[model samples]
Target chain A: MSKPTAGIFGLTGCAGDQLVILNCEDELLDLVNLLDLRDFLMATSANDTRCSLDVAFVEGAVMSRRDEETLERIRQRSRFLVAIGACAVWGGVAAQESNGNHAALLEDVYGPLGRQYDAIPARALHELVKVDLNITGCPIEKSQILAAIANLLQGDPPLLPQYAVCAECRMRENNCLLIEKGSVCCGPLTAAGCEARCPALRIPCIGCRGPADDVNTASAWAMFEEKGYTRADVDRKLRTFAPKGGRA
Target chain B: MSTTIRIDHLARVEGHGGVTVEMEGGAVRGVQFDVFEGARLLEGLVKGRSYEDISPVLSSICAICSVAHSLTSLKATENAFGVEVSPQTEALRDLLSLGESIESHALHLFFLAIPDYLNYPSAVALAADNLPAVQLGLRLKKLGNTIQETVGGRAVHPVNAVLGGFGRVPGFDQLAELRAALAGAAADCETMLEIVAGLPAASFFRAGIAFGALVSPREYGYYAGEEVTMALDGESETIPAPEYKRFTNERAVPHSHAKHSTYNGRPYMVGSLARLVVNRARLGERGLAAMKRLGLRFPPDNPTDNNKAQAVELVNDVDRALRIVESLLEHGLKDEPPVPVAPRAGAGTGITEAPRGILIHSYVYDEAGRLTAADVITPTAINAASIEDHLRRAAENAAPGEEAALTRAFEMIVRAYDPCISCSVHVVRRGHDG
Candidate 1:
């Protein structure tokens, strides 16, 4: 069988997700044999605009009207779609300014005339098109990418941990920063995967990886206020990558 | 009839830039470069915002060179308010900037430019045969990241850097680790130089093509300097940053949304090559020795040789970084609290040597110290025309008649200057006095 073709596209976010993939230093090249990177804008100008896509990975918050159209096009062409990182999965930091309720925010940003606003309110891939799988993190991890690719090659749905950062912290033998320093950490709320990077460094989790499924937002919010955090601070912290309905 | 090949979407340099190579009757006719970053209109966004609100917003103007944006913003703000950060603050900022230099330069060298030379699709493919070399690149790249993390507290959009100085300072042990690792990274620079020196470097791309960059009297301008030009034009000439617009001309090209630039209707280069050409005297002993030993011409014309020049600069930067750190510590360090002045209102400009090229940021402020206007002249935009000129010359030299090799030749020319597009987006700040 020929190699599976993958197309990576970035919408409107820091190109960090793609950078992370490019940063896979040692194993970076071996992918050519396993996957034909048919359309990555950052890598090369050579692209197959009409090729059949085996898998497509999309990064960044779907913010602009043009991006919504592009994401739908990608979804239509791709057999399987993966939302890489928190931006695509949960809208990410830039979305905070856009308001989680995409509809209301559309009115707020573009005004009530947003009703006539030609561009649809920027929404997650699932809102506009099918998202077969989602990879959650501030920036998607290499290991998860590898694992997902492996599963896809075998014709299986990709499996990734859906737990909170708390799970990873306890497993890493690191102390809980929230308890020790009285620092407000989102470890109990954020999706697990980054291995408690911020907490380990004595900084509280700012939730680069959006909220976990089982996250108790109200409880976490209360806990933060238990510390010295103001309401706005807690709001900003939880809202880094909040989904449309999650912030409220 | 002349055929014009316009590159509406020039690849991998940074942000959005385009190029045009006009071949009239198979002869070079006209070339224009432009920056097509569509009116992001960010200059208007920072207008009423406080000094504290400006950092992250400006930083996002370009993901690849956010450090430049942050530093330039800090500098212009500092200049406007007459603020002075501690020597410790200055040292850390330099270190972060140095880290960005390493990361940005390595990306441009390996991922972008080197691919054109080796005929590889990307750096990932090149890394296969050169795994160890890639690893060394990663380690060197990571050293900068470590610096950003230590000082800024986050690798991307560092929150710790602010108006007066840093929101927080690194502990002693963190500084020690960076100092030690940087000392160790010096070997990587030597190794990098050895590798580039050993690689098969193609001949000069264009002879007598002058380039310009910022250079200081006391030091090579990392943060500040006059715009110095080098070519047959002679040694360095100081054109103030505010005056860069005089030399810079932009036009809309059909090939790309990115605009093309020319200095007085002639293509010129910038970045490492420009810096190397302009600041060769500032290299002191080692830089001068490396230049002589590299056997590079007094002014190398071939665009491909810029990589070697960058490698040489890595040597210079590492050496300088070590020396600067040692001197700072030896002098018992100076810490002036970040001068805190509310925005009184004025227009100011700031320039810094972004890894790929010269980054100029200017803004006008209202009486409230809000940003009123902004203009950005990123290296990529400035060099786009020069890249086209080099490409036309390179393709003409490599294989003149064949449009088949045009893409390869074009990418090569673009990479030679190591353009960064995302850095080109701009707007002026409004001064309060206005």
Candidate 2:
């Protein structure tokens, strides 16, 4: 019997999802004992650029050309690769304002007048390589990351519920944002698992849950529009944090 | 024969970034603590957006400090609109900033920097072995999150925490309960300070800085201040943060998205240690007493001292919050919501001491309230050159050519300054380019 090897990598993100893993606090020591930890830059002073591993947990969307290379390198070395956040699952902010003039936005942020650190527009690591799973959220949820890790360790596939936040809101018995608050929400089209935390706070859901599976965006937008939001307003809400072409 | 190490994606220091060290000839040839963590470039994109759109958009710059970002954007908007938050607005914002400090610092210490000193995979490991300290850290972190949620309405990319103070300020009773929690933690903070002081010193380059902090002339500076100066040599000019670019030179190199900054082309320091060094006298009886108990000095250059200094600040902040609550209770409530002023068309510079260090936002707005041009220089950028200088010195001081030794030394310097790459990027390069 051999210990499984694991490496964790982060890209264009706040590193929150990774922190969530670290937030496991005490559970990690016993948990890590089950596997041989390899190449976690945040934890240890000793790390290698390459490693043989059973699992590689990746955070952040592949944004830069260099990032594309890093993503490819991970895919090459690891047996299982899990995309850990919205950035990695989708292109994230690269796709955030994609509907807006991307070229103009790029110019504003990258050049024509901005600082020079030229990069190809952001795209998810999945676009370039195989991503076995996506633990999606703006920064992704900690509980999900923990669950996914447990599943991997158990040789069982993680059951990521493919439902909109609306379903979860119903489960919590909270009032619907659309019906009660007259707020525009992407909850109907966005993924669940945050337990509809944002709408619970009395604020509109900004679609940080990432796009729900096979979401009927057209129907959701039509419903939102019928609720009195104009096409432009509904369009903005759908595109807030969803990936490119993800919105209806 | 010197060995250099590069840390890609420094996890849990509040965003996308990394550092690279270059060793040469058995010495640190040059180091580029580079942050190539792909910039979303919030400031660059907000140019043509409407006044209302700025706060919500920039607030997502980094999910961890979203409230601080929201407040900064709103303050910039207020300046553009020439609207003042009533005193209540100021108070609420101050409280949120305090919240930001607690949350950000706790996260830094517990998740990001602590594992190095304590020898663990992460704070998660420390929770069981060192449950009390970890629990206290989580409690304080939660208090920050709780405050943000109460005021801003949610944590991580908050809204309703807009310009002109909050959409709805907390009532007197709510403020009291919050204060009570802060009060309950006073003894815990004292214990944490003592614990932090026990952490070993981080080896840092010993070049002293002419420390510049917010000397409010009223009280221990938290938010408002016009001009503050260090007791440097006579006749030294006190350059403001608006002039921060000139005082702390900002430049870019090929390896990173973040620009490196230096004070007069040399590294300086900011945040808790720097703040205490500059304003120890005004630290009231409690702060002074805590300082004495902690045994900190005025001319502290070592970055590792920050761990101790943070514990010191945790004490001061909780003390301050409790006092604020008591004062409000006694003084009675009043009707005010961020001061009101005409949206005067002009250029302005607004600087506040974010928990990390001085955060400066300078902008030019048209009469119609458009951010025609904007520049946001976070405290991390200010400390970039200084971090590099410290790394270089730390590496030289290390037994040369040893990557682990060099990394341990460099990591200590970075942890001490607590530079936020999510706010700014740094490129540590070894030697001049070939």
Candidate 3:
């Protein structure tokens, strides 16, 4: 059996997801050996940019004409496309620009200059094209990505955690910040697989991994409001990584 | 006849960008270090965000330099709120930055820059014949990450070091383990230094190019700095950090989402090379020893010697980390919560030497504790103009009308700077065409 050919790409965000993959120090060598890698621009100078692939793992939101063209090219060439990290799975921090005047914003950053390139409000990968699978995190967890890749190679469906971060906190026997300290923790609404990292460390979860499958937006808002957080505060926390109507 | 040389998708660097050079009648007309990544409008987006959320979002600008971004943002925010952190907190923050420097420098030298010197397309290709070297690189990189994860809560964007102090400090045992790890890696560090120092020197040099870096009155450092020292042709001047705009006269260019920055009407250099050139005398005992061992002297003429500078920095950072860990262990770890904050309307600027170069994060906060304005000047944006200057020189020196040779030369020069296009494009203020 031949190895599965793959291409990993990044568009506009922090490039954190890809770095998380590189952060897999112990498994990187073996993982690369398991796949026919191509088009990882951050790690390789020689890329088969136009090569067809069994899977394409795309990170970052599409916020420019070039990103759209790149994502379209990869989508057209791959059998399956996986959206990696919050940027691709849900509009990441870049999507926070959707409510602002993009022209005015661009002017503030680069000044009133005639640009050869075009800038648009950031949109998730699914907003632009079909995403066969999605791995969510502000920067995707190394364990989740490694598992996703291994399962795909074994011809098995990748099993991602469907429960909220609250479940992980519960299993870890961590005290609930929301209930105990009146904190604005988003554990009940955020997806698991981070091992409740922020909450376990005594900091509130900011919902960076996007909402979980069983998230009850209205109920979570009500719960936080009852605990003294304002509706605006709750919305801001929830929408930082995954804004309303951002998910495809 | 006219011709243009293009390396459309520069790989192995942090973001999406390319280089283009145009020539008419065998003379260089124009050259651009274009940034093709979409503008995220982070400055505009960050407005109205709470002070606490600002650092976490800004840190996402570049994964490799997350520590620098977060720490600088915290500094700016703390200044806005008039917050003062404890000495322990300050030490931990410095340790985190050093960890990032070690991680980023090792990754760039071994995985990116070394491949260019060894005539390989990428590190993976190099790994085929040099597996042990690659393994050593990974070991060192993991050591850096271990420190980060132990202190910052996670490897990439830090969640613990907040506005005033850490939400949760590491335990005594954790610090001891990290101390032991740094001690164990000393021999590997020397071996890594030898591998980089022995590489064939990349032959590109132009005398009298300007260099800029943050300056400290204390020891050789990145975290403690309030002013910048500009080195120009054997003469140097110090400018306060708040007066950075005077030196960084940024300009908007049509070819790039990222703007170009010039100092005193000419392109200047930053990052490890610039840091060492300006602060060479402050290269503490360990840095001095490493420079001696590697036969490296101050003010290297070759831009590619940035790789060697990074090798020396790796040794310096590791030695610093060992001392930091020992100091923390001596004082003992505190599970102290973050200091309380009382916000007021104000503006502040935080400048530090990121792994690449100087990174400045300035912000204005409303009385309500939300952001009103924000500005970030990344090292790559400052180096963009300098990179283009080098590219133009490389093109001028190349055989006329040979596209391949010109393209390679241009790519090598750009790679030497290790520009992070993703971090560079998020500038907040408008720029003028210089």
TM-score of each: 0.77, 0.82, 0.96
Give chain B TM-scores in order: 0.86, 0.89, 0.95
Error of 3 at A66 (Å): 1.6
- Choose 1 or 2, whichever is better by DockQ: 2
RMSD of model 3 against the true structure:
2.5
| Interface RMSD measured for model 2 | 4.9
lDDT of 2 by residue, B213-239 (tens): 655555564565545454332223466
After superposition, the stretches of candidate 1 with alpha carbons farther than 4 Å from their true spots are: A1-5, A12-14, A24-41, A44-54, A61-73, A85-127, A133-248, B1-24, B29-40, B201-207, B224-232, B241-267, B325-341, B367-369, B392-400, B426-434
**Candidate 3 structure quality by residue, lDDT tens digits, A96-136:** 76565777777666666524346778889988888999999
Q: Against the true structure, candidate 2 has what lDDT? A: 0.66
lDDT of each: 0.65, 0.66, 0.84
Predicted candidate 1 versus true structure: per-residue lDDT over B303-329, tens digit per residue: 777887777776776677667666655
lDDT of 2 by residue, A86-197 (tens): 7677766545655455556545544442434534566777788887888887666667888888888889999887889988888888777797767788788888998887
lDDT per residue (tens digit) for residues B1-434 in model 3: 88977777788899877887888876888887877667787777788888889998888888888989999999989888889888888889888888888889888888888998898988899999999999999999999898899889888897887888997888898899999999999998988988987887676545557889998566566776778888877888898877888778776655544466777788788888888887778776778888888776556666766777888888888988898899888878787777888889999889999989999998999999999999899998898888888887777777766777667777788899988878886432111121
lDDT for A223 (candidate 1): 76
DockQ of each: 0.17, 0.25, 0.63
